[model samples]
Target: MLKKSDYRVVRALGHGSFGSVFQITEIASGKQLVWKRMTIVNDEDRKMALSEAEILQNNKSDYLVEYYGQFEDESEFYILMEYCEKGDLRKYINHLRELKAITSEDMLLDIFAQLTEAIFSLHSANIIHRDLKPENVFMTDNFIIKLGDLGMARVIMGTQQHLSRIGGTIQYFPPELLIQIEESEIAKTDLRPQEPVIQTKQCDMFSLGVIIYELITLKHPFADQNGEVLRTNIIKCKPNPLPNNTPESLKQLIMQLLCKDPTQRPSIQKNKKEKHQKKNKIKNQKKKNKKEKNQKKNKKEKHQKNKKEKHQKKNKKEKNKKNKKEKQQKKNKVKNQQKKNNNEKHQKKNKKEKHQKLNKEEKNQKKNKKEKHQKKNQKEKQQKKKNNKGKHQKKNKKEKQQKNKKEKHQKKKKKEKNQKNKNGKQQKKNKVKNQKKNNNKEKHQKKEEEEEKKEDEKKEEEEKKEKKKDHKDKKEDKDKKEDKDKKDKHHKEKGKDESSEEDKKGQVQHDKNKEKKEHHKEKDGKGEEKKEEKDKDEHHKDKKKEEKKKDKKHEDDKDKGKKDHHKKEEDKKDHHKKDEDKKDHHKKEEGEKKVETEKKEDKKEDKKEDKKEHHKKDEEKKEEEKKKDHSKKEEEKKDEKKKDHKDKKEDKKEEEKKDHSKKDEKKDHKDKKDKDEKKEEGEKKDDKKDHHKKDEKKEKEDKKGKKKEKGDDSDKGEEKSPNVVQAQDIKGDA
Candidate 1:
């Protein structure tokens, strides 16, 4: 029987209106097969497909088809059967049409016989295959005809039923089915079944007649496409007549099948004997094929099973040998590990003991050596102190002797300085006495010079009176000469009053000559007056020169006195510098003597420091011994724990492990807080330090400024003091 799962699809065979057919392989035998899958979309369609599957399942005709199984799913119904390489009768007709092959009557008879057998089987089962066309009439690759696809086949068991349903290819539908369809449609709207649609198994016979017509004439019996034309043609029972070359007997059979009258239409030709023989032969042949295929499969399966069993046995033995060798190797490894562990533990124990003993011996030896060294150092310190005392006494005696000698020398130098001061005071008094005498002499000389100037002035006045008398006489002479010249010019002009133009010009020229002579006489009188004034100025300038000489002599005397005073002061300063230099030399000798004493003290201190360092070294040596003991004990215990132990290592690591991230988080938080605090504190401290430093700097600058001021004042001496004290006087002067 056909089933959805029974065949795997290979390729599409063909398709029709409602569903498609595919060439598939039967799953069980891997043989090529075909499945007629109808798309059954509703309950009615499913019911119809289910009924068809049942009908095909009930059929016992080899000539009908090889119905393997029937299957169905949500959307489709499938009927699995043998694959016909040549396809169905419709395809064969088309193939023949394409080739224009002349089909024989015998081939038609053969198909008719196969179809008759198929219909006979369906009828025996009380089923009517309402739709029968060339497409439904399939053939095998071997040219074996098979009638299949009972999708429209109906159950008509008891009476000739009235079916108003209309489905199937319209071109293949007989006239009777079309007529019933019309009546059924009419009956539906009219709401009556009074005149029943008389449908029966004979409708299938009519469809068969249509297929026969197509095979013979290469055309549909109705000679119209699937439309109203085909329906009307089918209803009118107007099929084209048979061809001229058609066997009359087959034609008559076809005519009988297509008769318009249902009662007149022929039933499917049935031959029980031939069907039995064919059925039996088909059954035996299938049994033989099945038996041969099973034998080949069983033989191949047995061979594979034997091979698998041998492989499994060989693997089991090898696995067992491998397991034994691995077990031995593991035993040896464990034993070696145990031995190594024991040896390591023993070695660690010995090492710990050796280290402890060695540390103790070294500590005792160091203590003994330190005690002996300390005693020796103490004796040396005592001897050094005695020797230092002797040297100190000797140095004190020498210092006292040097001090006496320095004192005597200082007293002698003081006597000489006092004597020098007395002499300098006597010299200053004598110089002052002489300057007073010189100033008195200058006063007397200036008095005498002033008296002489008065005498010279009296003498000059007398000389001026004599000169003035001479000048008066010269002026009188000049006055007389001028009067004479003017009278002469008056006479000349009076005489020329009546003269001619040339005579008048000669009179003017003579008057000009008289005027020139008077002007020369007047100039000579002025020259004599100027000479008298020049003689008076010469007497005044001579007195001025005498006064300038007296002033220069006084300034020269004052400058000489200032120079003498400066030279005396310079001599006193040089004597003082010499005395200071002698005192500095004595001080340097004392400082050198003090440095020698300090060097002796530093040597004693160095010896004391060495003793202290030696004692500290002894103490450090003792500490090292203690630490070594502690470390050795710790190592011994640690090694014991490590020896022959794997679990302890993990346990210790887990115990020692800490959440570093949490620690880091805490540390970071602490660090941040510390940094903030430090930054704040540092800022405050830095501020304080900066202020303190600034104050210190100011104090230092003040001290430096004061020192610089003092030094500058000393360098300028009374120069600055005079400027400051006399500032009021300077401002008044400005």
Candidate 2:
């Protein structure tokens, strides 16, 4: 739950489209840290931002900037990182350039060593910093190089050639990457470059060489040209020669690093091994020099000791002879000195008394002088204090005058600021008035547009209604003609049958009854079909009416919403009232829609039930017709058998006819059953097709919703990395 308000911003370090970086101090801890705030819009951006933090956290190098922690809110991701007070290498180089100074050879070597060590650490972790430049290399107070800004870094698995988009500073690009730049230019500008550049650890080494060359020369090795020419030079030409003062070894090393082919460039691992060997060789040479100097010193000391010993022996012999002569002379002097000592003691006593009297006199004189000096010192102190008091008074008066001037100046500034603020407020008020007038005009225009749309919709609805009515009238006319044709055919058939069956009146009457029954059944079936069609039409009409009502309600609601919004803007005092009214209106509309849908469903169910009942009645009529025909035939057979009293062959023929008639009846029943089964199967297939269509629509809608959600997640764009100054060796995870 780390909030932006928790830390006080000192100043903005950088700003870009992705987010901003700030130098901030935690209020509670009072520690100054760099706060990198990234605005992440999608999952990919979020992963990239988090990878930087992860790299900083996992990498442990003395030359890498430390990662503190990270936190995020809904849309913004934050990273707290160590603040490098001395800034970056680019700034340091620029500072040296400003001073017209170049880095010493030893210092340059030291920087190069640290950079190699950082790159070695990253390479060991299989990470390649594709954007290595002086700007991305940070420095500490003690000039320790910290490699950072891994925004374009990628991780490669073993032996995998990374295919990458060409980015980073082109001047530092190796020859292999630079060669692709020309192909991109020849390509259409509208299309993205198709050629892929292979990025590897050697790219970082080449960039390191460029940074070193720039550090020494205070310019790019491929400098003195635009980007295009520089890239071409990097690819097809050589870097400018190092200065004459540059050591042969360093010159050779830089040249090797700037090799056109990446394979020719020295690897960081090889450089590290060579550095260790050089250190050991230097140590051994220092030991040999110390041994040689110690041997020379020992030889000189021995030679000096031999000379001193010989000279000391000669001096000792001469001193011994002189001591013997002095001993005899000292004995004679001691005898005379005993007598002189007694005489000298009396004279010494007299002198001592005179000296004591003089010393007392001088002490009195000194006391008188000390008293005079005290009085003079007191007068001088009084005069100095008086002068100091006047000086203090003058100082206070000057300070008061300065304070008064400052107050007056501040007052004038305040007055001017207030006047400016008043003018600004008046301008804002005028702008608001103008905005209100524009809004009013826009609202009027919107109302007119809506009216026109509504009118067009009304016309379309009317046209649809007319078309439906014409279609219904046409269908009715066709049904009438079909009914008239059926009647005419029935009458003609009745006349023809009457003429053919004049003698067999009973049989004809029976046939006529059967025909009448069949005609009536046909009429009933047609009537049922017409009723079913009418019901279907009514159901369709109800659905259309419901749809039109819902549409109109939606339009009305939209118009009301616009009017309410306008009212709220014009009359802010009644905002709450209008909101309540709007809520009520929406609820009312929703309830009405729901009720209408329920009624439509009920009507559909009624139509289904009616069709089912009609089917059951038709089946019942068919069964009754079959029973009546069978009973009529059975009675006719009984009367024939009773009246004939004829041959066995006649009876046998009658039986055969009865059996054939039964077989025909059975065939007819089976055909009817098959037709009913087929009709049921067709209806089932139609229902299944409708269900499938609905499911497909639902799936499409779901896909659209998901797409919309992803679209909403795609925010403005990612941030441009300035100088992250955070380690990135192991975090790309590629």
Candidate 3:
């Protein structure tokens, strides 16, 4: 009979020899439960079920499944438990198909932690679940694992005695269980006993080790076969080494767990506790080391950055100082040049005044000499008449001479006044000339400075234009290369079609023949282009050279013009010297009145020699300036040649780089072709091998069918099931 109101049986989930588990719903609250039903007609089985229910109901832990209730019907007892939606660890293992999913180390560690907690809870409760396998471990949707089946579990202090019958699933049973029983009696009794032959904790540890090994390798450590084969292997064989993919730490732990003797297996709780302590220590140490490393790295980077900044600041200061010094020097030079120019203008003015004064003085001296001679002659005539004639006639002659003398004196006064006026006007004109010359020199200096600035701007503009042109040319070349690469890739992809591939192969052969011809054509084109560019460059260079020559010629003309101007100045200076000598002679004549004029003339002759010496000094200065300008021009020409040589070297380097790039492109194309060919060959070989294997399998199957047909009844009697054959083959192989 089934209960109608209290509990509702839903559907069977799974069944084993001892019990059947069902997904059930409570009638009162509609709560789901995994109902484990066991037929417990025997008193001992009933006691065991009741005991298990009591143990489950008493113990409450997140790591263990909760027991809801226990109830009995007419024939069977039902134990309701918490339903785990994700089923059990066996399903998880099967889903992943491996012990560890790739890149799921954290998930594995979490599983280990939960499993350990579950086992620890069972141990603390003084109960031992003798069977702990992947199938007995339940997992929730959140991946929480709980040890589930407790059919083989025993309470340490229970009134019931230990059973001689074996209990646990064979695959996970410890070695002691198998060894304790005789080989012949193994089939007659259970393989596991109710009471563990060894320490219950140690036995559980062995089971945990098997679980860990399975978790790591996705396969049981001793799973060599099925049925009796697996049982035999478990009894006789040592576990294989941990898989290559397992972490070294995890593998070592598994190896220790897989030890043959139960005593040799490490305690699970102790290992877990120790690992926890070690992990905490390592985490603390890592944090401390990271802090120290960061501090040291920061200090080093800061020091280097500071040093760099300091260096930059120092360089900037020095550069500023240098620029200021240069500016000051230029200012001083300009001032000195201005001063020199002013001095030259002043000297020219002084020389002009001196020459004008000399001419005026010489004219005055001649006029005075004539007047004195005329007066003397008139006086001589008066004396002669006074001696020969009477007193009245002498008186009349004296009156006439007095009137003529008065007229001559008036005329000489008028001539002196005119000469004074002329000298004053000449002095004013010389002053004006000096002022205008100073203004002209200042304007000329300003014009020269402006011209220099304009030249520098023009040079910068030309350089910018050249840079822009080079950039444009590079852009064009890059675009062309990109286009060529795209074309090549498209052609290669298209050429993979069989028909197109054949055509392409033929074309390639033709292309190889045409390559030499095309290469020659390209070479010719390149050569012609290079030659044209070279000619253009040479033409530009020649134009520059011509410009330089023109500049030099202009400089030479300027020098010649300066020399002519200097010669004119020298001639002017010589004239001034001559005038000064004449004036000196006139002064000496006036001072030495009675002394001979011959002395004055002799002094003038000596002054002429001095004038010639001054002229020679002026010529020497002009020659020195010419030499300096010529040397400066030579230096500029040499610098230009050096620049041209550097530019030529740069051009050669650029051309070499272009050649290297072209070669790289060709190599890359060849590499791509080779890779495609190799891939094609590999695919063909793989297909052929697969086809051959299919043919062999087909022949074998056909032969087997033919043999079966020859003795149908006999074959049926003797033949094994296909499943049995496969199982046997697996057993044999294992």
Q: Output the number of the lDDT-best candidate.
A: 2
lDDT of 1 by residue, 517-584 (tens): 33332333434345335434654564464345335433534534465457446755864675476557
lDDT against the true structure, each candidate: 0.65, 0.67, 0.66
Worst 10 residues of 3 by lDDT: 495-504
- TM-score, predicted candidate 3 vs. hidden true structure: 0.36
Task: Itemize residue pairs with steric clashes in candidate 3.
Answer: 99-218, 166-192, 166-193, 167-192
**Candidate 3 at residue 163, lDDT?**
42
By summed lDDT, the worst window of 10 consecutive residues in model 1 runs over 184-193
Model 2 lDDT per residue over 255-319, tens place: 99988888898887656578687557545754675587578767766776777788898888879
Number of clashes in every candidate structure? 7, 1, 4
Give the CA lDDT, 0 to 100, for residue 493 in model 3. Answer: 44
The sequence of per-residue lDDT tens digits that candidate 3 reaches over residues 10-67 is: 7888887778999877654456778888998799889878877887888776678888
lDDT of 1 at 272: 75
Cα TM-score per model: 0.38, 0.36, 0.36
Model 2 deviation from native, Cα RMSD in Å: 62.2
Q: Of models 1 and 3, which has the larger TM-score?
A: 1
lDDT of 1: 0.65
